[model samples]
Target chain A: MDLFINLAHGFSVALSPMNLLFCLIGALVGTLIGVLPGVGPVATIAMLLPITFGLPPVGALIMLAGIYYGAQYGGSTTSILVNIPGEASSVVTTLDGHQMARQGRAGPALAIAAIGSFIAGCVSTVLVAAVGAPLTKLALLFGPAEYFSLMVLGLVFAVVLAKGSVIKAVAMIMLGLLLSMVGSDIETGQSRMAFDVPELSDGIGFVVVAMGVFGFAEIIRNLENQSEETRSIVTSKVTGLMPTWPDLKASAGAITRGTIIGSILGILPGGGAVIAAFAAYTFEKKVSKDPSRFGRGAIEGVAAPESANNAAAQTSFIPLLTLGIPPNAVMALMVGAMTIHGIVPGPQVMTKQPDLFWGMIASMWLGNLMLVVINLPLVGVWVKLLQVPYRMMFPAILIFCNIGNYSINNAPFDVGMTAVFALVGYWLLKLDFEPAPMLLGFVLGPLMEENLRRAMLIARGDPMTFLYRPISATLLAIAVFLLVLAVLPMIRSKRDVVFVEGET
Target chain B: MSDGIQAPSGRSGGFRIRNQQDFYGGLVLVAVAAFALWASRDLPGMRGFAFGPGTAPRIFASILGALGLIVAVGGLVTDGPPVERVAVRGTALGAVLIAIFILVSNYATPITAGLGLRQYETVLAAIVVLLVTIAIARGADRGPLYVVAGTLVFAGTIRPLGLVLASFISIVVCAAATVEVRWRETILWAAGLTIFCALLFVYALNLPFNFWPRF
Candidate 1:
């Protein structure tokens, strides 16, 4: 009954004319940027952060949620139409989505993807509402030791699930921690490693690092592969906008299973939409009677992953809202946004700011609905946008990023730092190091340090307090077990197979 | 440890690097760790139970150093793909062009005055601009050098030159990054983009931005 009342209040806030307008604007801009060749959601959201600066906290957060869904839908569109996944979550979609395009069933494939994503969104939004309260209750049980241990588990999950060498990933995490240690200390107010730069005293802006690493680096990389083959688009006409009954029937079970898998994985500390999509597609293949049909225009292939990714994207918010821990890089960006608005995310968010909390959850449903409604008829428009040459597009992106970074705090130094990080990003790419884990580590660094310090103080400097606490001990044990599982030769080989199969 | 011992006896001679990517990547990490250590050396460390600012950094840096060593050693023992080749000519050209732009923008006015050639300042600037464009047009496969140069220009000029000129210059420069650029088309596009951004940011969004140069 209380949930109903709260949800009703949430609807009232979300349905306000101004908030609705913001939501629409965010979705439109997010899709516009997301459909471009090389700009992923991380870069897209980072580039668009300035637009939300003046809005009320509720509207700002609601619009950000809208942008997230829109960017995801845009990524799926690119995957189906261009054989180029806009981001990693959509990579699996390219296999069957692009194949379906070649077979001239692009309309049905797209319609089914939207349908599956909507259903999954509907299911997971309810799941988020239902599970949110209990999780907040659980979060209340956590002490400083548990918080530290949980973050450690989250980092381990990121390293384990992330592709590439584990040791290198761990090293990247340490580097990120060191980088985060720059600027003024919280307790002592003593500056650490700033070298007396005024900008460094505030520490590095999240937007600066994200725009530099993801946005600029991606443009540089796309330029490197500027050969004709990379940007080829399927120019076939998309005729039938509706999926047939048979197509719908084939995908129903896959959508359900995907939603279930996605919702569960999304709640995990480090598991996010990318892994959810991969797991769903893999699981669907294992369960299908005709697994051979997967890569060859199967409707279920488009349905399962799309549904799972959307579901996972929404559900990943659970950890962020309840535990004050961002599950992935995208969530890390949200934390940055939240901090900007003077709103701290955690259990207190639910109790102290019920309107903002519930409003964001309700707005997500509205955002997903808006994507389905606005995007279907606008498919032709998006296809036309994608037709714009990459040469033209990259410049506009570069300018937009420059304006966006500059607009944040109206600081030119941040813009210069973005250029520097772009070089760093390019270097990281050359070395084959993953930047995602490093981002996760950077976001968590200060929080983890604070918790560890508090925990130690409470235990009078005894490091064994982490082991003495049941919850903290359990979390650390899971992290260790995951590390061991990742390092085991048998499991490592299988993990490689999963990734390799997706590419082939 | 066993792999490290066996690496010397394997097909290649002693101490031959097997995976150059991790080897070099790990070495860089170690260097970064060392730098962090040096930077935080002044901050106080642990005082009894509580951390004193520098403890966490030092701890993380040490761990990074150790992890980097392990990775470097692993690269020595493990067989992995060699590092991919980086395109040198294009990137070098881009870096040089950016350096020239920075030098010209920062020092051109002062140097011309110092040489008592202040009357020829515009000529000098125009010549440098022509040289940059010609070099851009003539260079084979320039890649994305102009893109970086344009961003830095916007950062340096946005405040003093304001949004209009900054946007115009940035778009024009960025458009030249690609080899397929048609100059006339790019200029028209830049004009249009500048107007759109100016109106959207300044009027519609009500952001505080100067449309023209402050001077």
Candidate 2:
């Protein structure tokens, strides 16, 4: 098949010694950060971003992609060994994985998670090869109005995903959008609400906002309650790592079901790994005959969610590579990465930079392979890190974060902004308001506004163009259906699952 | 859930301080809105036409301002009982250390070693940090003193002394400071890393570096 040959060519690009080394390094670092409870792919990627400035696009992207999926692998390590989920996507893992740890079956929990992730990752990469081209062609159909409507729907969906009172979520999202306006006014080239600060000329860096609010705020919340504890995960104590034949049989169905679900969901705009993992866990729960075992160390819980999350992660790349749409925060960063290389991701990407495109796709499968080989064996080593006190860890992390952020532009203003945002995030956490929706709003707000205004200007101020356009109309309908069906009921329940581990 | 571990009778001062974040955020949102509202006051024309450049930001800011109020109110007036409060000692100390970092980063950049590149000011900064380890130890502890001595021996060797000597000194000093590095264990790990980094970064990739000492 022509596709096979193209893929082979992609392999040639990715298999280089230099690219291989970067991939290995990325896998190692991503896993290390992932195994650590507090650090995440986003922070790690952001720190590594400046280092990527000089490398050729292929090598840089290969390494960055490794971090994203590798993180999914590393995050599971924490969830299985301790009750902590390093990042949000692994929350479901903690339910079952931690139980396994308590039962002294942490080894099986970890092994199954890693293997499931690998299988899911491989299958999703295949799906990407098959579907990536078509979606790219489909993207060519979008005009400014369509993009505007799509972004609006995306932001709304994000708000809907926040498990809280819809009103408060909406409130936080709106506030987030406002926070985004503090720096430069794009259209008029005038400062918006900067209050004459020189830093206002450039908009607030997304990295600074995310790191300060999410990273530092998390540390503060952790520190305020020092009596909280994590059961030490002694790797030596874990037994039955090689899943029993029965255990393997049980998990195969979940991994298969999860991969299919993840691939499909991942293709949609802004519907990435976290959502897929959650959706798979929900599905696995519904299908299992013994539903009561959903939380207390269910291998299916770890397997299905981890598999789906990895599958989603790989397939999520399909959109960004094929259509230039960001499914989540990390993909948004990838967009920045691509832009730095003067390559815009869209229909033209497949045609113009076929090597970069195919190479990246081919490399993901290879990267996933590298991750398991790199991580599974080192489970023993990472478990040892849990012994380090958070007091010692915190200072190092803070200093590193400070250095990374300040060196970004050598601006004290950004540092101040980071501090302010951290406080804001802490407040949001304290108030039981989820800030996840706000982050979505920050990304989509300007894009949505731009598209909407452009559509208005182009159609000579006709509002009906939104409904009249086929693609825009279709997406809007889905948004409405989601709002009416799933989101409304979730909101109506008024019970929110705790995303933060310890909060008032 | 334990009987003896009474849930906080009410929000603790720490919780209260954190709780005020919603209001502070809301207030800033209000200010943002006021500024936007004032800026857009001059849009003299009717809105039946295409939007002016500033219209969306204005509307967006206003929406945010409105949303902030709801968040602030919900935060201030929640009827449900708050969750149990327990101290997280590790997290607290981390915060304190980080705050110190923020202070140092903001006010001082006392450049300490190796490439006088302002970025390397972290060296001097890290040296100051050893004081915390010392302070925490109380009085007459050898750990703090050994750390300084080891650091001096290590920092002494850098460019003037060559990589092996400098690194050996620094590691021995820092390792000796609080955590005793079994000389054998320290040497093995440190040597492994140096060889790995040199082979992978220096030899294989051939990426240029300031391997020579920065005068």
Best-matching candidate per TM-score: 1
User: How much does candidate 1 score in TM-score?
Assistant: 0.93
Model 1 C-alpha lDDT per residue in residues A1-504, reported as the tens digit of each score? 777788888889899999988889888888888887667788888888877887899999998888888888888999999998887888889989989988989998889888899999999998888888889999999999999999999899878777767777788888778878888998999999999988889888888887877788778777767765476577867899899999999999999999999888877755478888999999999999999999998888999999998999899999899899888888888988999999888888999999899998888888888888999899999999999888788888888889878888888768767866776676677677777777778888889999999999999999999999999999999999999988785323524634310100
Q: What is the TM-score of chain A in candidate 1?
A: 0.96
Model 2 clash pairs are: A223-B91, A223-B92, A225-B87, A225-B88, A226-B87, A226-B88, A226-B89, A227-B87, A227-B88, B150-B173
Q: Candidates' DockQ values? A: 0.53, 0.15
**What is the docking quality class of candidate 1?**
medium
Q: Mind giving the per-residue lDDT tens digits that candidate 2 earns over B5-100?
A: 222446555344223545554565567567767754554322566675457767776786776665555445443434222212222333343455
Deviation from native of the Cα of residue B179 in model 1, angstroms: 2.4
What lDDT tens digits, residue by residue, belong to model 2 across residues A98-145? 888888888788888988989998999888888877777787889998
Candidate 1, residue A312: Cα displacement in angstroms equals: 0.4
Interface RMSD of 1: 2.5
Per-candidate Cα RMSD to the true structure, in Å, reads 3.5, 8.0
